[model samples]
Target: MDIDRRLKQLEDSIDENVIDVYDSNYLNIPIKLAYYEIDKYSELVRELNRIRYACKTYEEKELLIKDYIKIYLSSRKMYLRILRNLNNGAVKILYPDNLDEDILYRALKNFKKFDRGKPLNENLNTFMKVKLKQNIQDSNQELFKLKHYPAEYINTFKTYIGSKVLRYRNDLVIYKDAFISETEPHIYSVYFNEKTAEDTKNALLNILAYLNGHPSFYFTENYNFNRKLSELYDQFDLLDMLRLRKKFFFESKEYKEPIFLELPVLKQRCVLKIQITK
Candidate 1:
């Protein structure tokens, strides 16, 4: 199978609005590969066609089709992550108005219908609402706040992006009840792409840098303890690492807990483990 040609064709068909990688049912999983713009979608399709043409049996063609979608989904998510960083403002601006009303309705109205799914439609709406509202209600406030305490925004978005990456799943887990976790867990069990870990880490780093704050802190020579931590690029089990640290917290400032900073040391265990006791 000429995987490269198919990947290129798939990429060539992509467009910002025509086929929203974010909205597509096929591309919603955690993105493992970088997104291809519309120009590149054709390259992916060509490769897919090549694979189909080369397949000796129906099963092989089916396998190739599955692989093609899976890879494209992963790449799309990765692309979304890139946009999450490079175009945070744009994402923030367009999300609310451009939301797919049908999806939103299905998600909200048919909660009982899809038992294990992420309430994807619902989740999408909520994410957009929260992000857009924050951007809208406090555009100036966010700017002022970020300027005053850049780490707050940086830390906030980093956790959100990282958590999104970590929590991506192939199958949806549906529940009738609202979800809650009794245990505070930190985990980084995102499925790894066959692609280089460096690509994923670099994409993350790029997003981290653009999140309304100082990308410089990630490079502090004095904070060598947390600097780069390039080793984390290979650590596919970040979720487990996080869970072991037991220091994970929601990225909300309103929460009365501390979230993990993008520090390298926490990869092993919490360096400053704070215990609350009577």
Candidate 2:
């Protein structure tokens, strides 16, 4: 936690590998202490600036600066804890030498949750979930209403709609075996199904069109890929109402429906309830 010690590590870091500390929570590891090895100095400066901006509402810059310093200090304590608990033999066999602080922090930050023997659900699995969670909570107030609905609905809907739209798209098999959950607040996630992409895409598009009186927001007869969605939505100037999935809905290129419009934002009942295949 000492600033001097962290500053020393940051100055010495110079490699590109992670160091997993198995004995504790992965993310809590102090990363700033090992910043010397982080490759892009520009990125560090950018991040620092962003953090600085976030703290700007405070009248005094001193308080804001202290907050950033605390973040770095806390990160270093974690790094040291990981180093202390590493298996003696595993450390020798895997690393064989001291690592620069930067490499150690980067490696640890990138550490897969699996490294700690946790289940896939415990792991973030992907950044998509993070983005999805943020969008849904920030945008879909109505859909979020369902979260407060009786659990019975959440537990039963997919079977309720299985034969119709929620059925399996890949085979004759139905999503009678599906289930749904919220990985993050407001993000209603059904177990991935054969028709998941289609079901979600259509449901969202239909809702958006119904609300906006547009021709069911579509590509300009040319846009093709999930990455272009923001551009296309912006081109049509629909970005204010559109959002990606795992937050409010799911998104996949294979699924004809790429964006799920948040109907709840208008404070209306959700046009469709999710069906989980069990």
User: Largest TM-score belongs to which candidate?
Assistant: 1
User: What is residue 59's positional error in candidate 1, in angstroms?
Assistant: 12
Q: List TM-score per model, in order.
A: 0.21, 0.19
- Give the TM-score (vs. native) of candidate 2: 0.19
Q: For residues 156-253, what per-residue lDDT tens digits would candidate 1 score against the true structure?
A: 01111222222223221111211111112432222122222445545444333232111212222344444334344334333333344444344423
Ten residues in sequence with the least summed lDDT for candidate 2:
159-168
Estimate the overall C-alpha local distance difference test score of candidate 2.
0.34
lDDT of 2 by residue, 1-278 (tens): 24345545654562212333222433333332222122333344356556544542323323344434443443444334333433221221122233343433345465322234543222322322332233333323323322332121222223211101111232211233333433233323333333236566456445444333222333233335423653454444234233331353444344333444443222234453222211
- Poorest 10 consecutive residues of model 1 by lDDT? 173-182
Off by over 4 Å in 2: 1-93, 106-204, 208-216, 220-278
lDDT of 2 at 235: 42
Top candidate, metric lDDT:
1
Question: Candidate 1 — which residues are off by over 4 angstroms?
Answer: 12-87, 92-107, 111-278
